[model samples]
Target: MSEKRSFLLQKQNDAGKLNQSKLLKAEENARLLVTLQKKKKEVEQLRLQYKLLQAEQSAANKRIDALKQKLAEKARCKEAPRVHPINPPCLETDACLRQTAIAYLKARKQGNASALSRHFAPDCNYQYANNREVPNEMVMNNIRELWEKWPQRSYRLLKVAYRDNHVELIYIYKYADQRNHSIQGYAKEKWETNSAGQIIHWREELHPGTSPAESAGYRLVPLNIK
Candidate 1:
């Protein structure tokens, strides 16, 4: 009987140990679950913060782009330094017309006399203020004579007007050395271009007392200094 009671006691002790181990495992599982839930919450908060950062960065980029565009527009306005807008016959032909006119003037100032012919039509006519119409054959000679009289001649274009096939210019003419005389005058010129963009007709209207004579006594045109 005592042996049987001892065996019963050992079996009861084993059952109690098993029950205690099961309880410990259950407590550990609960602790792990709580920790996992907290970790998940932290992960979700981090994701939300990341989304907010992306949105803010996008807005900043848009603002930078807008500022850059504004600066570019200001730069464009500063670069254009024209006093008056030039209206060409056709938008597509504006550049060519202006380029040709500039090149012609540059050639004349540089004393490239032979280059002048290429800018004019075959049957060009030049009329002076005295109603003297110089024929095509005498154009180069007249130009050479004018250049010889005032070797230091220069022109400042004051105003320019343009039409479909015509251009009118007002200019201030200056010759620093005409027998030690500083001569200046105003002149108006009109140019008529052919369909091929070659100058076919030209007219000159020099202000009174502006014409120079070859003689030493008439080295300067008599006019008020003003």
Candidate 2:
């Protein structure tokens, strides 16, 4: 009976030791879980802070870019050209037209008539969109009349293109009488050259795209330009 009791006590003690070890293991797992949870919260906070810092940096860069742009614009404005009382020939055209225009502009600047006036052939006629024909005499007369009426009247070439002497002009014209408005127009002049490379006969068509001739030409040319 004593031997059986001793064996039973030993088994009970071993079982108690096993249970105590299991309890200790469970407590260690709980501590590790708490540490993991704390680390997770710290990572989330760092991520949020990083995102906020990135957003602030981006905003600051955008603001800096805007300021730089404004400064560049101001610098450009300060370096802008000064237009004179008698507007010069700023036309960018072929050598022939450019030379002619420059001479005309210099004469006008010196309070003289344009040298181009003598080149106008009396037989030449200009056709309008209304199919009205105006003689060279009429056109020249109108130019002189307009010039006299508005002394400050002048034209400037905004752009130029020449493909085989078909010199095209995108121009801007303004008069003192029409201070609030300016004329924006395009001119395509066909070439007729003299032996000296002077333009003898220039058939000028103004505001071409609206004309029947331009429409016909565009149809023959390309889809991209039209």
- Using TM-score as the measure, which candidate wins? 1
User: Which runs in model 1 stand beyond 4 Å of their true positions?
Assistant: 1-88, 129-135, 208-226
Task: Give candidate 1's total backbone clashes.
Answer: 0
Best by lDDT: 1
Lowest lDDT sum, 10 consecutive residues, model 1, at 217-226
Determine the backbone clash count of candidate 2: 0
TM-score of 1: 0.46
What is the Cα-based lDDT of residue 112 in candidate 1?
82
lDDT agreement with native, every candidate = 0.67, 0.54
- In angstroms, give how far residue 174 of model 2 lies from its true place: 35
Candidate 2: RMSD over Cα atoms? 18.9
- Candidate 2 Cα lDDT to native: 0.54
Model 2, C-alpha of 180: deviation from truth (Å) = 37
- lDDT string, candidate 1, 1-226, tens digits: 9999999999999999999999999999999999999999999999999999999999999999999999999999899796542334453444455456566666667778768777767666677424444555567667777777777767665544566567665567776556856677877667787767767788767774553222222112112111
